[model samples]
Target: MHIAYFPELALLFADIRFPQDQSPNNASIHLTWRPPHGEAKELDVPLLPDTTSLERIEVTMHSSPTSAYKMGETHNKWLSTCLGYDTVLAYLGENERPVLMSTHQKSNQPQIQQGGGWLSSITSKLPTSLGTIISGDTEPDDKITFADCAPFLVVNEASLHDVSRRLPESEEMDISKFRPNIIVSGAESCWEEDYWSELQTSSGVKLHLVQNCVRCVSLNIDYATGKPGEGESGKVLKKLQSDRRVDKGSKYSPVFGRYAFLGKGDEGKSLAVGDEVTITKRNAERTTFDWPGISSTPLPTAS
Candidate 1:
């Protein structure tokens, strides 16, 4: 589950970054945390050593239920103290979870199964134009991290600007509230991304637009105070409800951005900042967002 489940997490500022000079496989990544009312601290969590044993735990996501490896007690204790609860940090070790097929995927498309060692052999036979063949040890095209729905959530800067324009004079919307993985600019108009079916970056990485991401109450949380906002700030979701409830699949929650997954041949590729994104495919009509797990039931209306 996302930290949004515990609204207090909004107040926790964590700076997690990878070392620029080292390959990700060998980089020493660290997390610096600034709690609402405490000394800023750094969490030194090393990669799971081969000798360290991890407990397999089950975690439920919006799209499906999957398993993950629970981290050690020290890290869990630190996070639990920050959140004022007993919290366990779960790590999605490689191959621990498979990306579940979504309704947005075409029925006729080939379904990538988990632990399919066949991908390595198939990838080697493909033309080099498709990109380097990824080894089976690395994440397969069908695998995902602990993402809520899709591997990526893409938002248009123009659409965010439009939302800011609609806010009260004293209140401006921030991209952090939406929690998008990619922020795209250069759109001809606001919400133009709704019609985009596929996008390719200048670097050749491609993403297939899936469902429209549904808005949740977490958007109203004030990151500064770690509590629900006041006045107009708290009503961002309500404001969007007027015109953003366009996705019939998730009727109560307004849609803001598009959920996406990496295109088949673009896996194991890196997308740098400022990469020019081009729409490679367009939907003739706006996609009707559908996810039976969450959309099939009614959601609580945002206050």
Candidate 2:
């Protein structure tokens, strides 16, 4: 379920907060929304296994492939009514979807071997390789829920500020539109994250920076109206396409943020706002953004 294909989904707001006394043994999410010309509705959906038979569905993406459990008729009916169309909610259980192999330190074996000494030692300290990091002969414990590509998408505040400066004065760009899982500030220049290979937080959580995140038409969506904007807001992607297509992989889409995954021993670690981020490793050259499952296509140069 992506806003680019189903714009109406933007109208639905999910309250992911759990009750203070909620336990993993009994978990659920509460959803509240009011359809157009309809009364407000709310539902507390149980996360535990139910008697309703679920359909297993194959979910394919540019980065990797996975499976999801599609909810039965009752849950689907409630969600469909809110969206004003027939739809189904899918759930990807823990460890169901592995993080992309390209994002793992083990995937850069050739570079580590060539560099030797320090470079190899640093990565050696990281988690052991998880086979292909997807469906392969071995199943991986390091997994993500339902992110598009990587487990985390990190954006630099300075880079976002640069983007705002490029936009027309009448147009405004919000960081929420980019949907980054983490935002780092105090960067000296815009787009400096392109060279970052790894980051460590003040609390010792480390992230292996993988690839540049590709932009899409969803950037032009106006959350207020749940529709694509017709003004400068609609041209946000076009504006980024003018210069942000630096990655050789996925060249057709503009790059704004870096996709990343947690490093060794950082699983289940907690991160909060205002945490200081330190760039632990940086590439001498910008990453070309290559992945095993993704195909790249060239795009016309901006006029």
Candidate 3:
């Protein structure tokens, strides 16, 4: 609920901080913007979930003023891991307020209906909290496939905890090990593995729960704090693989994550905190998990 709209959304500045170099004046990550829809217009936003600069984007939708700033997956990850945040979904009523539902807080909160094009409206029912309007098509309800096309509903922090419980203390959370765009709050909750399967927010945003996000060694690096990981991110990831959700060994399952194609209408809606998001069930199964490999895919491939 609370569908607030803005025209010409834009990102003014971006920066990232890491524990490796926690200096207050350290030059955090930054990005260069060309204009409203410059040559970079065709370029995809960096989908990487961890990098600070990659986490933020400047969005301007349909001449709305007060340009909306979209936070990439990293911001979501921090919220769950560092903060205890959860949400539900619903559509905006005539008054532009979210309706309520009796659903438990799931891993992928405020699931946005995903698919096609960048300047579109995502009307999902979300637990009253935060929301953002994004560009892209919400994958059709019947067309399910695992590709980068699905919107990400990641659980970075829970994944870390899942890993920590299994692995020895020596292996802790390192950003390089599990780089996720969104991290949910709370412990003992298999946010990524179980909850994501069928969860949504109040804003009528649809989230296609694809699969458990797999991890790469990049999480081993301490990006925020800026120090060679003492091997924390890896430890949590390994533990999850061994004990938590996504048990590949039992059935030879390839590790995969979920994706939701954004929905239609309200192209380029502005999402902000304290909005309603909604998630609905789709009869479609996701496509195969085919995200470009970590090493092979770079920021240049976001579009």
Candidate number with greatest lDDT: 2
Question: Of 1 and 3, which scores higher on TM-score?
Answer: 1
Question: Per-residue lDDT of 3-63 in model 2, one digit per residue for the tens?
Answer: 9977666666665444578554466777776444457678777765453477788776654
- Candidate 2 Cα errors over 4 Å, as ranges: 34-40, 48-53, 98-101, 104-143, 291-294, 297-303
Clashes of each: 0, 0, 137
What is the lDDT for 136 in model 3? 40
| Model 3 RMSD vs true structure | 17.5
Candidate number with greatest TM-score: 1
Off by over 4 Å in 3: 1-134, 138-153, 156-160, 164-188, 191-199, 224-228, 231-234, 244-257, 274-279, 282-303
Taking the tens digit of each residue's C-alpha lDDT, what string does model 3 give over 1-303? Answer: 111111111212233443466543343444322333333222122222234333233322221112223344444343233222431111111111111111122344444343332222223222222233234443322221121233344342454454455546665443323323334343233343343443343444444454444443333434433233454452433434443334332222324234333444434444433333332342232223322332122223345
- Residue 252, candidate 2: C-alpha displacement in angstroms: 2.3
lDDT of each: 0.66, 0.67, 0.33
TM-score ranking of the models: 1, 2, 3
| Model 3 poorest 10 in a row by lDDT | 93-102
